[model samples]
Target: MMKLDGVVAFSMTVEAGSISQAAQRLGLAKSVVSERLAELERTLGTTLIQRTTRKLSLTASGETFLPRARRILREAQEATAELAARSGKLSGPLRISAPVGFGVLHLGPALGRFLRDYPEIDLSLELDDSFVDAASGGFDAVLRHGAVGDGRLIARRLAHSRRLLVASPAYLERHGHPGTPGALEQHRALLYSNRTSDWRFTAPGQGWSVIRPRAALRVNNGLIMRDAAIEGLGIALLPSFFIHQALAAGTLVAIDLGVQAEGAELFLTYPKDHGAAAKIRAFGDSLRRSFGSPPYWERVEPAPRAAPI
Candidate 1:
């Protein structure tokens, strides 16, 4: 097989117009360049250049080979330039995985701004409730609710997500609000299958306690459970961010504001030891800046009075 090294050496030598010039450009010894050129000539069984005291000139055979050599060098130069640009610039496809509801409500708009700022970057986003294998799935990064278990994957806390027990005014009117956690059992509740049946609470000057409510419907999606609660289906336990708009609009009310689950968090994760992968870094930084400081996700959404229909 013809080695790219020899071809590269020949190309550089021709462009540089001397073995010494090619060596200087390539950071190789002049002797090494001369040997590679000789080997290339021997391999092709043709004398490509004639050496003179003043300057090196291409022979008849060299004239034909020169163009092809320059073409190869040009292609190689382009490839190198492309790779360097990719490494430094926030350009190319970045695959990201996130939870369905969060992606649609929060991340979607954020990504829109990110795309605007980095028009060169192409995004491949997948939102689902199921666990994702970032490495195996060729994902550049992932945003997950709660702390991750895998120590191999790297994670950065994007926000502090707090879970809340909430219900609609209409449902509370029909069922009445439970003043205590134990009182929840008397009321209908919409629960997620992924969450525990027991709900936690804390009152003024009281320690945390857990209570299991009587479920009206068990669901898998937080958005659906939230929607059901908004439409007066039942009380729902959900992350504060999911129902922020609803809560602000007076469509949903936080039932137990003084309690939370143990060790709940939200994270943006990616593979470790990835140094200066431009697209990933840009996206990660953009996320960090977007949810900067205490994190917008952790902010409590106030209940706005219902507007007249």
Candidate 2:
């Protein structure tokens, strides 16, 4: 019988494109992964991988064996999931990937509750702002906000969040609030560096207008940009989830430019075949329950206050 561990290591290495990355994903030492792959090759009586100082390539046998090896892994997982579902018990490791801000602000608490509910399940959550490929990264699921264009993955809408233009009361007091989108050019903007285009908005009467704010400071994190705006740095266009508390507390006020900002769709995405997996289903259901129909953040409407002097 083929060793399942060796097969998994070989498959993960091929998917990740390097032994180091596979090792990191598998939570194993590089030497251990190498030894497993070598053992697998020895068992098969063939050279599976051609490794050199600079690069690693698959031998002819490795290329031919990869598809079957992947099938074996997939079948084993499906079978395990089926049995686990029948027993109504969730076990095994569930790996998840999520954006840093959302993970920190929302998923952290939600996952805590989930773990308490399913003690048998081992969960590993990776928080990163960079985009992660769910299939290749070996993640069971990924929590993301915005469009998921990958056809291979299945996306379930968790909730919706809108972007709001906001600044600290002190900042707005010092810098006059803009009455319109066009007026945003005059203000010092604290921009989120990850956004590809300019800020855009729409109103009932007005169509759509885009403004590229003169970035006084650009940061990759939404929380940092929101805090900087609160520190009286500059106006920031940020997601409501990040600013809702400040808005409610009157520390940050929304700039009513008479236009509605674009809303973002939060999704819990996973491999289509893995949808029936106990852990993925349980987590997805938990997220849907936690966020609810309108989401908890959206329920806290920002109080209206007079424009700062």
Candidate 3:
């Protein structure tokens, strides 16, 4: 009989485009993964992959066998999911990836509740701002904000947010608030390094406007940017979810440019096949419930403004 481990190892290596990456995803040693692939080739009496110093390519036989191998893996996963569903018990490892700020601010509580509800499910959560390929990363799901561009993954909308321009009252009092997007070019901007410094806005009469602000400080983390903005460093265009607390507390004030900023759609993304996994489904549902329509973080009322003299 063909060894299932060997078949899986071969398939994962092909998908990952490198043996090291495959080994990382499989939680196995690189040598073990290579051995499994070699064992599978010997059992089949055929060389499936061509290995070279630069890259690995599939042999003609491998090209033909790749789809079959994937199908086998899919069917095996579905079989396990079916059994788990029938038994009505979610027991397995569920790996997830999320943005660092969101994971810290919101996912922690949601996960606490999820863990209590499903004690048998094992959870692994990775937080980072870098883009993660769900398949290669071996993540069961990824919580993402903004557009879901990958056609290979299925996305479920969790909540909505907006990116707005904000500055501390002290900063605005010192530097003066810009009445239009064009004026932002003169001000120091605290920017998220991963994103463009150019900010965009739209309004009923204003149509659309974009401005490239001078970056006084650029960092990968949103929390750092938020802190800088609070310290009166400069203006920042940040996700509403990230600054909601500060905004509500009157530490940060929203600048109305007579136009609305872009809306951010939050999503929980996963492979289509993973939709059948009980753990994935349960977790997804819990997130939907926790975030609700407006999301819990957004539930606070706007801070009361001082009366005009």
Candidate 4:
């Protein structure tokens, strides 16, 4: 095969007017550049450069070979750029699975931007509450909360889900706010079916404790939990992403129970064995950037505190 490394060295050395300048341009040592010129001349069976103390001059043979070497360098660069552009242009079937509530509520804008940037990406997004197996379900990536289980998969965390204990002004006014976790037993609890009656909480000084609130309503979806809380049905524990808006608008007040539950994290998981596909990486990066460090949803302004009934 015709080697292009020496060809590049020779072309740059000529164009740069000196070996040192050529090395600077090529990001290689001057000695390495000289060696390349020597090796290239050896391969061509001719002295391509007349090296001296003052400057470098091309031999008649070097002059004739110089044009061909420069042409070779251009071709090599064009070839590299073509392959790079092809790789940069990510396009393929990108199958993904996510929880229905999140996908519908928050993922719309992110998905829109991704589609605009990569129109060639044939996107297949399945919004379901259940955990979907990326390998068996033929999904390229899966958006999941909590823990990512499956040795076959590699996970990238998107954000930490901040759970909030919330109740509407009406509900608090009617039932009175519970000041302590233990006092929550007297209040109505709207539990998520995915969650248990045993809710865990902790504080910087208070340590960890489990609060088994009585469940008045249990549903499989977060929206139902949120809406029930909004409608003054009961106090609901929900993700900050789902209720930050209501909290900011004063439709719901964040109940500080003197402790906080550790939030489950959101993850973008892909098959570890399938190799990192361009489309999957692109989508994952987009989501991460959208979420940012603290996540855009968590940026809500602090809501007004509800007073005693």
Candidate 2 lDDT: 0.85
TM-score against truth, every candidate:
0.65, 0.73, 0.74, 0.70
RMSD of each: 12.5, 7.7, 7.2, 14.4
Q: Which pairs in model 3 have colliding backbones? A: none
Off by over 4 Å in 3: 1-76, 79-88, 205-207, 306-309
Better of 3 and 4 by TM-score: 3
User: How well does candidate 4 match the true structure in TM-score terms?
Assistant: 0.70
lDDT tens digits, residues 1-309, model 2? 569999999999999888998999999999999999989988999988888888789999999999899888878887887677556577778899988988888887788777777788889999988878876777988888888899889888888998988988888878788877898999999987877649888888877878887989988888898889889999988888898899989889988877888888898888866734557877887787877778899989776798445
Question: Candidate 1: where is the Cα deviation over 4 Å?
Answer: 1-88, 201-208, 261-264, 275-278, 297-301, 304-309
On a 0 to 100 scale, what is the lDDT of residue 92 in model 3? Answer: 75
Candidate 3 shows a clash count of 0
Alpha carbon lDDT of each predicted model: 0.76, 0.85, 0.85, 0.82
Best by TM-score: 3
Please, what are the lDDT tens digits per residue for candidate 3 over residues 22-115?
9999999999999999999999889999999889999999999898888888888788776775565677788999999888888887898888
lDDT of 1 by residue, 72-185 (tens): 755665565457555654566678898888888888778877787778777889988877875456787888887677876777777766677778889888877777667778
